[model samples]
Target: MMMTMATAAAVAVEDSTTDDVQPLSTLKMQAAQVAMDSGAVIHASPDVLGKNGEDSAWVTVNVTAPSPSAGHWVALFSPADFGYGLPSYLLVYMFANVSPSFMSSGSGNLRFLVINQRSDYAFGLFSGGKDNPKLIAISNKVSFANSKAPVFPRLSQGKEWNEMAVTWTSGYNINEAYPFVEWKMKGGESSKRTPAGTLTYTRRHLYSYQIGHELPDGTVVWGKSSTFRASPFPGQDSLQRVVVFGDMGIGQRDGSNELAGFQPGAQVTTDRLIKDLPNYDAVFHIGDLSYSNGFLAQWDQFTAQIEPIASKVPYMVASNVVVLCRCSGNHERTYQDTGGFYNGNDSRGECGVPAETYFYVPAENRGKFWYAADHGMFRFCVGDRCFSSVDRKHQPWLVFAAHRPLGYSSNDYYATEGSFSEPMGRTLQGLWQKHRVDLAIYGHVHNYERTCPVYENTCMDGKSKQDKGSYSGAMGGTIHVVAGTGGAKLRDYSAGPSPQWSVVRDKSFGYVKLTATDHSSLRVEFIHSDDGAAHDAFDITRDYKDVLACTVDSCAPHTMAN
Candidate 1:
């Protein structure tokens, strides 16, 4: 059950001399050939001839759908050697009814399936005449939602066109809702349902869905096109790695300038970081991506500059303190507020944008800003930028991270007293104490300070006024390390004499390297950017009971008198 259609057009190729070759008359043919010797139906198009060889040529192929249960498949072949073990050529397959719209409603859903010949990294791009755009995810049948399966293989000189099949199940009527069976791939066999003794997909379980085949180094590469296939499983794993950061607005000197140093030159650092991102899992930006004080142009520049990174990765963001808007008496409404340094002093009703936003890390914890991920033995507790709540179920070994810090040096400029004014301080502290969170990583501070694990301003030491070094062995303390000096301006350090909780403090541009040894031991190293050397290092170990023994009772919080 197969139908084929092909169209021929002239294409120009560039030669070594950088001159466009003359357009040649090319007849593009596409046919369904079942056996090698005995050919199947051959679909041919008229030969396309052009006067100039300097132009590009395009050919279109359309294939018919198989019977409801016939399981039809399609593969594209390059002109050089359409057969296996041939030269390198691009193979493209196109299908009809890729996304059918329903009559009752205007919405339509499109699905595609893609497979690679060997293990090589590839991405897909879509371009058309219209501006209509939508979100899409590529995944395999088994782990489409969680992308646990390795990517499809890549095509070497020996390998031929890899088959990418898209199977469509007719959509039901608008009023009807059907339960599709879930699909599972185990030991390379597709399983419609879990076998008698097989393990089924669980909410807490983490699995990899391979979009294509994996390379020798376990790197999965995707195909260039979108293919849709019906899977036995109800849902597919289509997750990608993303990185998110916000509150990176343009400021006069303090805010923007400082932030620029760390992520300097608008898009320089951000672009490089984004470009260097390892095909990420996903990005969750809390807020303040770009400061939209009054003018829309600033926002445009920031967004445009960030496109390099955001376009590649899923740029999930929240609102922040810098966005401008208005305040309604009863119902808070936000329009464009152009009342900042960049924009004119017109009262254009610009209000600061609200930041507490949310996105999902599918196959992981969902519906919460604070989510957990199991990267190696360490469980990363990425707190909601708002730092409001914590989910205990998803992440077991909690290691929290946020933009703001609850504790800090007693610098008058940005005093620590009012820093934790938001409920985040109490909420996160309580959660950390309850779960014995191994490490709490934070930014925002211009300086870097590592605090011995202390709760409620009290170091775990029961002794008071003890020598500075006396409280060194305070076990189980939540080490509050500040590594905000990624590239930000260095803040002035004012170390208190015999400070009880503050273990180490440094005013330098640097980043922290966190290595998780296991569920129990974790190593944190602060690398100073000046010399590319680690200035400070520390080790934190959890007890057999899984509780961090360090408490605020031992090392008392520093007071003005001390």
Candidate 2:
């Protein structure tokens, strides 16, 4: 199972009352709710109180299927249209990468997995496609409804081409149904069923989102491309381009700027990404992804808005939870403080603990969230060459996506707190240098700034061979970039004097575009969200002098070892 460079693809309501009708409040007392099969129809009634309050309370009328009568509710489209009007590349990618459907209910839970031969990241190929997608977890056929998984699948789950995985969650730990995903590629004749497992997942989950622009002919719908494999071009072995940005808050619907018609920040960015689909292979939403820290629903809207682009490609993401206002910080920041954003321990409780108080960190969040993520990913990306390789995108370049700047970036927020390095707090700074990381991409300051290749507040050695707006990363310093202009409000530079190593800064709504060339060179560009302008561009030449060759024993010569 060898996978090459990843690729990009362009990128859920209820019911009514009837004999199959019931009330949600009944959910509390009844042992269980309706037990229906996939695509089954059921009705629900809302509890209504009248003139006499509790004494005279009455139930809202349940209309027939989709009647929309008082208290009537219905589930549309079987599991509901995850997304539609997708292009071809996206569909193929999903079978190897993401989930096509997810369901759970009191009757039972369903977790469909797309397992394949483990992937060989070196070439992005799998020896065998999975038998049939498996339902890793299921409850019973009675309650065939379930929510989506809680996290996204990691880029390395199916490390072997013969062993990919599609995972989901069940509301209940108990099991009942002999679960399976009976599926076939669209237009094929028969569907097959492969048995699923009932186990607690200690990893990522998947949720569907859509992003598109309205056109006279028709709206190019995109959503279901939630999970997709990373593939190289017909002859190439690396990605040609990838989009990067951060601090994207779901745009508000106002009559001002940042909106294309009624669409706002997130929507605007989504539309841009979709239209430019073929030009880029993947997306890197570094940090501060959804400015919806406080209101989690904003996360829903942001994802839905970006479906057209995200579904078709591998959307890699991280976290940023500082200065997010109280509510937002309450939910998002905990991941950073206690390193347990997803799973909380007694020390942190539901909220997170302070810096040094915990005896031990919880298992779930330990390897996943915040700055700890930096350490985890550092090792993941810088690991071995073949079998145990996690950061398989090792050939062309090594880029890091974090929420805050690790070096000087012309930002003002932390200037008064005594320079940019203080907030960074040493942990990330050390690991980066040790790993010899080439590029550091961040968002948070809301403005874009480019720093000369620098280390320890000093220019390491090289300078761009090209002009200012377009330079070479081959320069001796590590290029520090702040692409915070994704969609959040902009921030001005600190009052006086750009740092000695600061090269350029742009204040606008835009994102980044990266191109990898076969010459072991990486070209980075900043693209505007409003107008597709190349505000900034640069190239970094990667040195693969010692990149090891892969094999069980004997191996071929290294392509990148110069």
The global C-alpha lDDT for each of the candidates, from Candidate 1 onward, is 0.33, 0.39
RMSD for all candidates, in order, please: 21.3, 19.2
Q: Highest TM-score: which candidate? A: 2
Worst 10 residues of 1 by lDDT: 153-162
Clashes of 1: 77
lDDT tens per residue, model 1, 35-85:
221111112121231112111122222222212111212222323222223
lDDT of candidate 1 at residue 189, scale 0 to 100:
44
For residues 114-136, what per-residue lDDT tens digits would candidate 2 score against the true structure?
Answer: 11111100001111123211111
Best-fitting candidate, measured by lDDT? 2
For residue 6, give model 2's deviation from the true position in Å.
28
